[model samples]
Target: LSPADHLVVVRPNYATNIETPKAIGCAISYVDLDFDQGFAIDIEHVKAELRPNTKLISVTCPHNPTGTMMTRADLDALIALAEHHKCRLLVDETYRDLSYGERLPAAASLSPSAISVCSLSKAFGIPGIRIGWLLTRDPQLQETFLAAKEQIGICGSVIDEAIARATLERRDAFLASLLPEMARRRDIVQAWIDGETLVDWVRPQGGVVGFPRLNIDAGFDLDRFYTRLLEEHGAYVGPGHWFEMPKRFFRLGFGWPTEAELRGGLAAISAALRS
Candidate 1:
């Protein structure tokens, strides 16, 4: 990889904390998705970002924070563009299993130029497992990724892999049990948001996170609001600045704790908002 190789990334992405293009020696480009339009990526905008040095395109299905999914047509267009440009397309499908509608075909399954990465972290509630996989039909690319991995962590711990394998083996039953709980929690969060007068958001179509914008007309101090919420109400939600968004928006996670905890947290947040 070289700095001259431009790797385009979608923002409000889940894997931002982990896989960064700059870390891999690639220049970065970004395609801004329209939040008002369900956060759909504009294909034309993406094409406009492309330059002669562009070498890769990356996207997250069931996007982080907003939980918005890319349409099948949009994904196909991205894959086609990658093929036309002779660049790699990497699709991160960490939340694909939690999606509402028919899941799009894995990019790796579509073309040798595409790569797919998935993990047991988000949907499976197993971040501690630290097990994730990259899929590609191209043996050369696979070998190259493996070589890179060898220079890093080499391989996952045996125990972690065993647990991950077990989780995969019982995935159907596990998902069956978990889906209802996630759905229920999502509803609760939605209801709470609906009841709020000072907040607005596009309902998430899938996944565990939602981004809501605060109705602050004239420079309401988010730092003050967040600090007060944390100190007085003991409520914790991620600040929007972390996602490169306007300070009025904040990321809420509905998947981390039990229903009781989630409710309590929401109540505290609501109280903070009212105050």
Candidate 2:
């Protein structure tokens, strides 16, 4: 979508989702996910914000940072709203394979106006390949998007394509092995968060990360706290400032580390917090 296009963003969205549109100066409309309700998106609230000039309604699930999944019914409602409003639905399905829940139909399959973008990075565990693909029934938009892509010279190298192809060929094998471990890691994270007196979070349904907020007394600098966690205890986690959320929040990556390492990291964070 262009700068003049009005795009609706689902929050606490991935920063890229929010920033990219703003960088283009799009007339950004936000429908903040009700964070208190496990980050649920309200379809009626989204419809209430729609404008005649709206061009796209963008969303992500299994969502970034929060790792929440949207129900199929919710997706259907969103697609219907997009259709009625004459706007395209843009879905970032980067973590779709990692999500644990009832399956939602590919938005592209459900409607021609929907576009789904996916990459091997999250689920396929081939982020280094730096390759991703898009699906769209709207061939005209597909062509236009490709033209923009072509202008950027962003074509994947041959090796990247080969890796992506092989990964897709063996997708089930990779997922079967990876998913259980991810679930286990998430459990560890949940337990760790539960143990924290001054930290709590919206537990992620599936996917690797959780964004927990530090319930600090007034005068706490989360930026400094994170720095001290790194410098003093060797604990490293992403702060919410990076994602444009309130400074009290921090991201925990449960899926990326080995279980023992993650345990050690969490303990280190606990120690740092206590200090």
Candidate 3:
């Protein structure tokens, strides 16, 4: 929370997770998720990074880029760890609503020490509204957050709030239509990965994205691949560097593109590879 405090972060994370703590000048440790391990985060790995001054531990569910989902038991363990250490656990649940199976309970609902963060930017595709919120059971903490918000700006746009409210009111109906389509797209992606010799991936459990690493052993020309993917095929992916990862890895998003576009993108990847 301060310059003298220690913060534990899960990586390779969204930029906000890394940048915010660095900006605060907090002594930081990273619990780096391993691609070989299916990007799994273990409680023991988290415990290893803990310092006595550790004030917050940050993690993501249905993680960005990798799209790995943590089990409910793992989440409970994280909350217990935070409680035992007398620290706070920040769970970024931005992609929680897009789960392929059962979704974990909101972290804040599980414990006063745990916080949940979410936005309409991801699942609902409404980033122009710039709406997001943090959840905490501690009233004092909530007040502290409001005070911080006051310092940043006068108030959020009324139009954005109204739109967000309307969206939330119809969330279930929206998701009911959206999720099945997401699953279909997800399957198409999975099938492409299964057949593609130039890449390998840990199948995403949820969310719109998957991190797939190019098989460098195949001697694929990555520089050409990117150039062709963009110039010739008119398709793009989030290069691994976007998430502070190796160049061999890339984030493929399935949620936004139309079915035809998704297939074209997959084909483009293959075409790029073959080139």
Who wins the lDDT comparison? 3
Q: Judged by TM-score relative to the true structure, which candidate is superior, 2 or 3? A: 3
Model 2 error, position 54 (Å) = 0.7
How many residue pairs in model 3 have overlapping backbones?
0
Error of 3 at 33 (Å): 1.1
Identify the runs in model 3 with alpha carbons over 4 angstroms from their true place: 218-220
Each candidate: what lDDT? 0.83, 0.83, 0.91
lDDT of 2 by residue, 1-275 (tens): 67778988887776777888889888988887655787888888889889988998989888887888888898999999999888999899888888776656778889987989889888777799899888999889889889989998866599889888888998889888888888888888889888888888888876788888787888866667788899998879988778667778778888777888999998887777767
Poorly placed runs, candidate 2 (over 4 Å): none
Relative to the true structure, candidate 1 reaches a TM of 0.94
lDDT of 3 by residue, 161-262 (tens): 999999999999999999998988989998998899988888888889999998865566677778889999999998888888887899999999888999
Tell me which of candidates 1 and 3 scores higher on TM-score. 3
TM-score of 2: 0.94
